[model samples]
Target: MKHRHILLVGASFSGAVIGRELAEAGHRVTVAEARSHVAGNCHTERDPETGVMVHIYGPHIFHTDDVEVWAYVNRFAQFRPYTNRVKITARGQVFSLPVNLHTINQFFGSTMRPDAARAFIAERSDTSITDPQTFEEQALRFIGRELYETFFKGYTAKQWGRHPHDLPASILKRLPVRFSYDDNYFSHEFQGMPAHGYTALVQTMLDHPNIEVVLNTTIDQAAASGYDHVFYSGPIDAWFGHALGRLAYRTLDFHRFSCEGDYQGCAVMNYADKDIPWTRITEHKHLSPWESHEGSVLYREHPRECGPGDIPYYPIRLVTEKQMLAEYVERAQAVRGITFVGRLGTYRYLDMDVTVREALDTARHYLACLERGTAMPAFTTSPL
Candidate 1:
């Protein structure tokens, strides 16, 4: 088989994995990242003063049920077991997250078993509405208005910069209200954090003889024509220069500060009250429960509207934005030699494991196409 020149834009998890796979297959792969560093949003590094492995962008806990993805990441870096136990502060009281049995008991001031708690919550729930329409309705129908208002209402509004009523019902699909005492944030089969951090993991993926990395470089549409195959991990809308219309995205602003000692008790503390401007407070030291630090580094995360210059964090896929994305999908179908991969490429919020899994699947698909002498897909998993 003849070797092909593969150009991958964006050195994120998706781009890095695809580049490594293609490179190992005897294809010459070049990765171009607009940012100076790799590992896009999952970037992490140790604090110089405190010696804590800080999540530079935000907290990223790798968790997945896929055995292949878990084994694949372990090959690159050692992962330490870390389970996220988030706490929310509302009305001057701190409570366990995921609306667990402990949360229900504490909130109502009673000791209830799983069965009793389940019945109690059901009785409190508003079942008048048969079909839920929006995020607000879904939350109200499941946990009742009191819990929803105290836990999700203010936080959701602050995070998205809009009322929860405007958001789709699918946004609350992942929300879990447990009847048991389990407080783990994620229920994935495999869950851990990289001991050396995400940057190290990405570095290991890119450390291949056949893979060449060019950071702080932007690849234009014209430049993409030179490569035999193109893997674009950048924003799908930006690829077409927003010809259809720019998809709305929410960006985050972090206020970093160096504290003398421990700041927040936990790694994440959600401010559920509307009085608080910031959404959550994250202390770097608490992220790695196995390690300890003298001084601490903290970040007050504030969600903001994404503009041209701001770093896009979350894509706000509302009703109108989905329509615009459909138009972009139509345009992408006509484009050749390019395969859009990753969260931004698909314009959907994805976890670290899902992103890696998609990239691995994409690589396999590309190999299958090569063997069959078939054209590569312009988009994997419908953008619509």
Candidate 2:
């Protein structure tokens, strides 16, 4: 295979993983990260004030059932065992997340078994609404209005910056209601956090001699023209400069504050009440349970509309955004010598493990295309 110099627009997992795979294949990889750091949103740094490893973007727990992805990440960084047991403060009461049996029993002040609780929830659910359209309707159909309002209602509205009625029903499918007392936020068989934080893991991936990481550089499509192939991980709409229309996204504002000793006692504590300004307070120290820290650092996460100069967190793919995305994707297809990858590139929210999986698959797909003597398509994975 002829060695080709490939330009990756972002140095996050999407770019770093792809770079590593390609570099090992005798290809020169250039990873251009707009931010000063290599890890995009999964960036973690040691807090100078408290000596705690703070997730600069937010808390990211690696959890996935994909054995390949789990083993692949472990090769870069040693991972410590972790289970994300989320706690939610709803109506001044602390309850385990995923609306488990313990939470249901505690909420109603009744001792109910798994079968009884399941039946109870069924009775409470609105069977009248045969077809649930919006998020509110979906929650009511499955978990009933009481549980929906108590937990999902306020949090969903705050996270998306839109009313539940306007949101899609698919949004509510992520959260599961378990009859068992299992409070584990995710059911993935493989789950852990990188021992030295995500940044270290990414830095290790880009350590190959064939790979060069360019920090604080915004490499647009025009700038990437010199490369044989450009794996653009930046926003798909951004590549074309939003010629059709700007896709909607939700950005987060983190208010950092420190306190002596353990603050929340847990890694993540979500404020389920709408009255609370912030969505969740993440205690960084708790994230690294093995490490000892006298002082605790936390981030009060606030989600709002993504403006021109904001770091886009979640893509709000509403009806209008989807329509706009179709136009941008069409433009992306017509382009040559470029392939869009990653969450922002695809215009969707993705977990860290999924990002890694897709990155690995994309690299393999590109290699297969090259061997077959075929033109590499604009996108290895479908954005839609």
Candidate 3:
């Protein structure tokens, strides 16, 4: 059996998972990370002043129904139960998120039951617009103008920096308007936060004898060719020096503040009004409800377009961006001795579980391809 030398860019969940798998399979894996920390966007560290676990980027609750992924993460660190109950301030009043039965009743000031609330919203909704195309249209068709303006309109504009009419309808589809009073943000069967921290978990994942992790090191195209095969998890456009121009991304700017005692009395409080410059305020201490803290640390999240040196949070896949991505994908496929994996590599927005699942699949596919004496394609999953 010939041992292969593989180069993996980025030390996040995707890179670490794939590197560990390949290293365990008798391959020498080298993980190159530009950031000093291991976890990328999911990085969490203890606040030096407040002694609270803070999500450096933003709150990332681990919620997924994938049984294998859940078990895999638990092997590294103990997961404490967590339910993301979000609250929103709209029209000078606080309401439960997802526009539940209680929220509908509170907004309308009626004691209507679930069925009656449903009927009331139906009456309020614009039934004339049968087929919704844009985000604004979808909101108006389902929840009516009042709810849309109060909750969705201002927030959507601030978050995306574009009018809801210009965005795709699918962006709003993930948000559910529930008839029940359930306040859990996600509908997944398993939901929790790692007891230690995401960075610690990632460090554990990269703790193999055959794996070498280089921090604060960015590998260029010249270094990529030295390895037997390369697994690039960095930005797809960066790999090619942005030959087709940079793909648009939305980056987040978080404002941190600390106060003694409880802050907002909740984990997350979203300001639905557009007047507010920042989108939401999250109390870090409340994120770990099991632990007690004398002081609280909070962050005001503001979303804007990505600029140079800014960490891209979300990919803005508009019509033009999709065409640009297609062109890059075509060029990427022609390259040999390299494979693109993970979210940035494939140029798609993916959750932690999906990233891990895809990394496992990519490693498995690579091994199977080698066993069959066949060459692996640049992307295991098609970006287009």
Provide C-alpha RMSD values for all models, in order.
0.9, 0.7, 1.1
> Of the candidates numbered 2 and 3, which has the greater lDDT value?
2
Model 1 bad stretches (over 4 Å): none
Provide the lDDT at 26 for model 3: 94
lDDT-superior candidate, 1 or 2: 2
Model 3: lDDT of residue 248:
90
Measured with C-alpha atoms, the lDDT of residue 250 in candidate 2 is 92
- Cα miss at 11, model 3 (Å)? 0.7
Candidate 2's residue-wise lDDT over 61-84, tens digit each?
A: 999999999999999999999999
lDDT of 3 by residue, 188-307 (tens): 999999988898999999999999999999987997878989999999999999989999989999999999999788999999999998889999888898999999999999999998
lDDT of 2 at 87: 98
lDDT of 2 at 71: 95
Top candidate (lDDT): 2
TM-score for candidate 3, please give it.
0.98
lDDT to native, each model: 0.91, 0.93, 0.91
